[model samples]
Target: MKRINRLYIKSIFSALVISLLSCSDDFLTKEPKGVVVADLLNTPKGVDNLLIGAYSLLDGAGSSNGFPSYAYPASIRNWVWDCASDDAYKGTTLGDFATGGEVERYEALPTNQLIEQKWYVMYDGVSRANDVLKALAKAKVNMSEANVNVLSAQARFLRGFFHFRLQQMHFQIPYITEDVADPALVKNDHPVWDEVETDLQFAIDNLPESFPGEPGRATKWAAMAAKAHVHLFQKEFPAAKILLDAIIASGKFALVDNFRDNYTASTENNKESVFEIQSAVNDGTSQGFNGNPDSWTTNPYNRFLPTCCGMYQPSQDLVNAFKVDKDGLPLLGIGGPKYNDTNLKNDMGINSADNFVPDTHLLDPRLDWTVGRRGIPYLDWGINTGNEWVRDQVNGGPYIPIKQMFTKAAQKDASHTTFARATAINYRLYRYAHILLWRAECAIEENDLPKAMQLINQVRKRASDDFVMGKVNTYAFPSSVTIDVDYTKPAANYLLGEYKTFPSQAYAREALQMELRLETAMEGNRFFDLVRWEKDAEVLTKFVENDSKFRVFMKGAQYKKGVNDHWPIPQSQIDIQKGVLIQDPAF
Candidate 1:
């Protein structure tokens, strides 16, 4: 339970592998280096170090195969998920990350390298987790049986976590475990939910409720939360509710007073964090071809910022989704007066340097926190000058991502300088707010409208605290003009209110769905949530139809009902297994 330095652990891992290489024979032609490393991993310290390596993969980088060309597939941020949904556009030009553009347009094929690379990185995580189990079983260490159980449980949890991510992307993926001696012979013909659930259950039963010293390591609460997430996706409401209720009663977590704190580095591993990926910089490691030699660094700053490639632009629809009524409730759908109407206002056609006014109308405070629109404070960075921050406003729109970008003051301590931008910001995988919303969904499915409304209101009330504005420090443009103002002032007519009641089950469900979209926005769960609720077709079809009007890139995008629900099994993977892996139906 000690605060284990990830950099120190990685150093040990590197040194051990380096020590195994002799001057005589090439280690590549002989037994795999992992086999040699596993032989030395017989002591308790060695087993724990191996477990650390498994944890390192949480960043979705650091593979021995070298970094993936684009950070989308490898980074835990999963920008592709946001792009695939209505929440965001594949920013930049058409030719940049062309395969990703195909995904955004719903034209993805089995041969898309983006999909294939994602499959490779996730499977590599599975293989690494399995390696820990293989080594643990063979170890001759004189550790207590309880200690071994905990280690084995941690390894199984990681294996399940990696497989679960694959399952979300490719529903019928192969669930590789320690039993599988050869992964190439495995088949992706069956649903891995059963295996994933089983592994998570073991982890839930074995992991400690809290690890005070090691904040980022998975705990019993995290395992339970992850298992419940799987159940929610599978529509097992009763099952999910039980775990969620326990987490809520455990008093282990609570939403931070300021929602923006969840995204900042200075306040990481706060009370709201249930499980977060650990990232560190300036740890004395040299920056590699991509960024830091350590694959844990995030590259969103490279692409999402306007000063850079300006990829992952927030969609106009998403910006409009934040519009609230006079009473602070969301004006839902395109039928609403404010919906998709220019009255809501944006920088779509305006130049950044030209003097223009931002739409200071009724809006959700979270909108400014989530999207860096023109004229608003962008977390200690200068006021977002629309076109100046945008690479090509004509193609990508005029908004840049804000949640993951580091503040200028914290950049030295939080990010790495490279050919592209990279940062040490930890990607929050599970948080208490997500738990609240998932529980609310379960309540709605169980016909507990009052309970659902109450839970939903709790989330809203926290968001409506109105203290977030004070937490943000505004900066002047041109590095000269010193115009001081109250940070508490509404950025853009910010108005968000709690739900009073729900007249019908349908109404409650609709409100719950919209709340999730508004709350999470661009954190990469929109597409998956829609799929889980079986509302992908209804939601995305309308989103594409409406969004295409403004975003020319989405002109031909279509969300096929059943086929698009799950991505196709990579053609190369099926070919590698020689038909052992069956493609999803209709692929």
Candidate 2:
């Protein structure tokens, strides 16, 4: 959405690199070199630069070492969250990312290195945000009180955002601020929801409706939307509804005409994007893996690219959840017959060389947009070739991720090839469609079935209208074969329609839940949604049971309620902090 200034971004990167190179216990505490560095930070220019540094952490890249690793816990893509949920599988071949496999199988221990890495990265973000506020507090340059307030508001917003992420993953976390002189002394034992709300509210009050030159920066609407999301997760329906209604009345956002556009680089930061993590490629940084100072790159291409490691495959249960009846409605009956028995076409047990066709039965139009199935044109990368494209189909199944990838046409400007496929595809943390579904959930919980149904149908209508594929001239295979296919043809027996009315509140509740799962299938929200609904055990237990039948790797998987509700506080963190952080139950 915003063409981030290369010079400005590079300056921020340079500062971060210098701080990292010093090898201090805390990078934020690094002393400024001289008048140039100190004067720059004390003036208005310094405040802006510091703000950019705080924003840079949104990508979850906390190092200047350049190598893209899954160890970065704060990755906006939510790879770990997706794998832990029933919507996806740890698609990489066995013996690769074994720690990730443990997470996938519900066997993660405090010793899991990935968990520790993530804990550090998220706190790193919190620390950066606090540094911005601390810098502003002691600035020697002349600045208006209003300007200072705005900067503080933005910094606090980020602080709250990072803390909220920790709470979501770990359930209990210490809320750090600029006032904290020594973070090591903080305890991860208390709830920080009140502090989070205060920070977000400050942002909502101070942020402008839009930043003209900085499109991806947080805005008033972003703050409100994020706070609303927090309330929804906390089951504060009425409180969340007030914020959602205000957002709708603001008239600053709406769903784009095409659902696929929300995922592609060609149409990022459109009308629907509420808050997006900005990424950049080939930005004149020679640092290679570590040198790109702006934290504006991602490794989804490397992981999701069929030819690469092929991690994060969509699950068959997720695919089957997309099935619709003749009337274009989800086949509804919770705790009833599993939908996988409906003869839905799948590529399990079938090889890439085998003659197979995608299920042509009536289905939701959003399925093709959310998943890369066999025989479907996977953007410009050609038809998905089953096992050939998958790293291990028997373990992870056939589907590859689609929503987070960039197209070949857009890759020139949006992607870079280092050790992995790093691209500038912004990870959308909040979008209009997400807001609609969340508001629907609020309404449903409040017993406002009529209002909930209307909101749900609004989202469904958008998916139905945005189902058409883009124009493609020719499809090429990785093995040097090319073929022509009608780009306008539907990839499956696609059919979807708006509900005339909800049969009852129970039916409406089920429909609303299904809508959330389908609308935000693999963007890392599923497991959390299950937890929020208090249905994690029921849904995931059924998911493991049904999916394990075909996906052998998941045979022993189980979801123990209360225990699996939150990941154990990383054991490494506990030992390092000398028991400042207590482990959650059933660890």
Taking all chains together, each candidate's TM-score versus the true structure is: 0.90, 0.90
Question: Where is model 2 poorest over a 10-residue stretch in terms of lDDT?
Answer: 291-300
* lDDT per residue as tens, model 2, 34-114: 646654566676667667666766666644432356333457666676688888887767777677788888888889877
Q: What does candidate 2 score on TM?
A: 0.90
Best by the TM-score measure: 2
Candidate 2 regions with alpha-carbon error over 4 angstroms: 1-9, 12-40, 65-67, 70-72, 286-307, 334-338, 341-343, 417-420, 468-484
**TM-score computed on alpha carbons, candidate 1:** 0.90
Error of 2 at 242 (Å): 1.0
Backbone clashes in model 2, listed as residue pairs: 65-290, 66-289, 66-290, 73-118, 287-291
How well is each residue in 129-181 modelled by candidate 1, as lDDT tens digits?
67567667767357777787888888889989888988998869887877776
Scored against the true structure, residue 347 in model 1 reaches a CA lDDT of 66
